[model samples]
Target: MRIQTILALTDFSSPAEQALERAALLAAHHQARLQLLYIAERQEAKFCDPQARLEQRARQLSRRHQLTVQALPAAGDALAALHAAAAQADLLVMDNRLHGRWRWPTRALGLLARMLRTSPCPVLVVQGAARAPYVHVLVHAAGDEDSGGRLLHGAAAMHAGATVELFHVARPRRGLGLACGEAFARALRSRRQRVQQLAQPLQSVPHTRLRVSDAFETRRNRVGLATRGLDPARQLLVQQQGTRADLLVLAHAPRGVLRDLLQAGKAWRLLAGPEPVGCDVLLMPQRGPVTARPEAAGDAPARQSAVARRWTQAT
Candidate 1:
């Protein structure tokens, strides 16, 4: 939630520039240090001086945003360099079109999925321009309870003025044969109740001002659920578009399930699919059972207690 250092990866393209602008805006708002990293293609680097350009841009951003900005040196492997740099950062910001295209290569998608899975901090994928501050933040709360709470806290902390809404999509049980109409109705009711139960704990997190919504509600109601036959990923996308959210937050899938999600599941579609969502996306890495060191000092205990209170309040 507390961001002290942000790393923005750039290739000097338009999307990257927009991402940098957004990152600078966040840096200014949070009083955080902003580090600019220019990733150049091997052939392009041979023809131009990347470091000089990177430093020049960093200086311009520093003067413009009135914040500390540093240009990181280029490395041989882009993914390796990014992973190494992200290790020390509190947040990582990058454009969706890092390769100068929206439809990414298989290898690139694999590397990105790996980074999201292993990054020490949250990753922000900028899909749109930074015209203004985010007004609506939609967080996917269908994963681990702890992960969902952490994401909600982070989103609330980062965009304090924005309205944060938590939503869950109840996917129909798989491999089950068709049921009678009455049985199907009962199943639907059960799923809706389960989603409500899952979201109940998040409503009481001490520091977060979250608006929890039932995705299964009718179309006439607020935040209506997606059509019944769609997968959870498509359902989430539909809900995000319906709510007109400026930002969408999701926790990284767990290790055992991560590979499938990245390769052909929801994460893949949202992150690297042909169709792009209207809002920016933030992906939080899954934390382990043991507590890791806090990104910011002096707030670790308070943050932990806040999460603890969420669980305690649920019971």
Candidate 2:
């Protein structure tokens, strides 16, 4: 994907500073324009000139990095302001810890999760220090092949020299003894074979630097009826620790029932865990080629055209 504009939102915290530095690195790498956005708290606004300071920082960054930087400062609801500003951006970069919290049952949701839900483009949640030009990137493929392809494309676009590993979690079947784990392992292997086959042409054709390696680990709940609804997030966290990845890419909720469950449960847990994850996270939206189902024939043409447009740009 061609990234033309990157929007970096900041609350002026240490994490936000790291995000800004990372954003500058990305902008310099992709030759993309940079937009620095800050939403002022009521008390801070009363005491300081946020817009002027924001513009000053922008100018400083522009001069220091020799790249275009635009500073946008706004007051009131931060989420609303960010949503409005991110409309034209290809990537939204922000801190992992921000205002608001996720409320599942209620209408209110955490600012980060809520932004991921509605963002027009992919959202990159940057945590920890400013680690530029990621050396080791990991893309969690899970069960979605399309999402995996998109993740690989994204990784290639962002860091051409980074060692990219596509990791998959295979959940073993229950009540089948050793056979359950073996079966899941075989299935994961088959999936990896298919992914490799699909990627062969991509490596030769356009994404030459997007070569990706693959790995899978089996995760099964403890043997018991009480463990019926085991959480996958914990296992995922464990696997991430093993990889020690610099960047983790994941797809957001898709339309299918299984995907929705994964997103609503495991994905939510991962994002809302008690402790922060080690690496940066990129939450990709659900986007793919339109299906050929006859019931949706009316909209198929438009969807196909849109896909074509995207493919053209990627080419």
Candidate 3:
């Protein structure tokens, strides 16, 4: 959860520029190295010098933010290049509007989802303008206790002084047949209790004590819990809108075939919906076994194994 390096993906669009600005602010805040990656298509490369442009921008950002910045130029497939570049990065920052102008929202969401699934680091999908440092962060907590703790810790680490609220939605069991008001109330109470128990460990830990790194010495972020009815995606949106949170954090776990058939992914639904959530989103992958990085044969396993251990401990 300690961010020492951030990779910002850009196509030189307005949205991409905004995302880059946000990334710069974060890099400055964390005192981390910022890498600007510009992937040029074949046709674009044939006409313009992308490497020069990227270097110029990197210089501007470095001067503005007073941080180390590197310009990375690549040609061909954007996704493949990003995956490769992100292997050593702690976080990937990118605009929600990616690629082709027409039907770009859908395409961008699809691309974002893919990046979230595959990226070795957390992906920050910039939606709103980065006016200032994050103030209030809304985090979605599912049934997984460990994931919730990690999300809380990560959120606290990333935005040190921001207030974080852990939001959970409980759905009643179908076969319970709790048609009676009292029975339904009991079920709701039970679910809420379970969620509270899951979050107790996180809440009990003092936020100021969380020491991811020197740059991330978090203030006492007032952690609170919220439970609501079904339709998780909609409820999350509503909760964010109501609280006016500047950032939303979600765990990007793989969906089963049954879950996909039954409902759209929550992250996809929120990002791709007609009404935007009006907040930046940080997607943390619920990783399983670590994938071997494309590194030297001797060094790759040791490095990847260490990374796996860190992630395991973090969760």
Candidate with the greatest lDDT versus the true structure: 1
lDDT of 2: 0.63
| Candidate 1 deviant stretches above 4 angstroms | 41-47, 75-78, 98-111, 173-209, 218-230, 254-262, 288-315
Reference-based lDDT, residue 18, model 1: 91
Model 3 C-alpha lDDT per residue in residues 116-190, reported as the tens digit of each score: 657878889998677798888787755335444677767776666677776654223323211122322333364
Clashes of 1: 0
Candidate 1 per-residue C-alpha lDDT over 1-315 given as tens digits, one digit per residue, 9 for 90 to 100: 789999998878788899899999999989999998886432364538777988999999999989999998776776777878999999999876423343344424444555666788998988889978788888876543544467777777566567788766543322222112222234336456654555454455444355655344324221222123435566567778778989988877545333553456466677555655678998887675523222446543544454344323322
Q: What C-alpha lDDT values do all the predictions have?
A: 0.67, 0.63, 0.65
Pick by lDDT: 1 or 2, better one: 1
Query: In order, what is each prediction's RMSD in angstroms?
Result: 10.9, 10.8, 13.7
Off by over 4 Å in 2: 40-47, 73-80, 98-108, 172-185, 188-193, 197-230, 254-268, 288-315
How many steric clashes between backbone atoms does each model show?
0, 2, 0
Model 2 C-alpha lDDT per residue in residues 1-315, reported as the tens digit of each score: 579999997767777888888888889888899998885332354437767877887888798788999997677776677888889899999876533333443112445655766888888888768756787677765544644477776765665567666655433223321222233334446566876764554464332433333222322222211244323465456556766778877777534434433445444556555644577888878675523213334543544454345323323
Deviation in Å, model 3, residue 97 alpha carbon: 2.9
Error of 1 at 303 (Å): 35
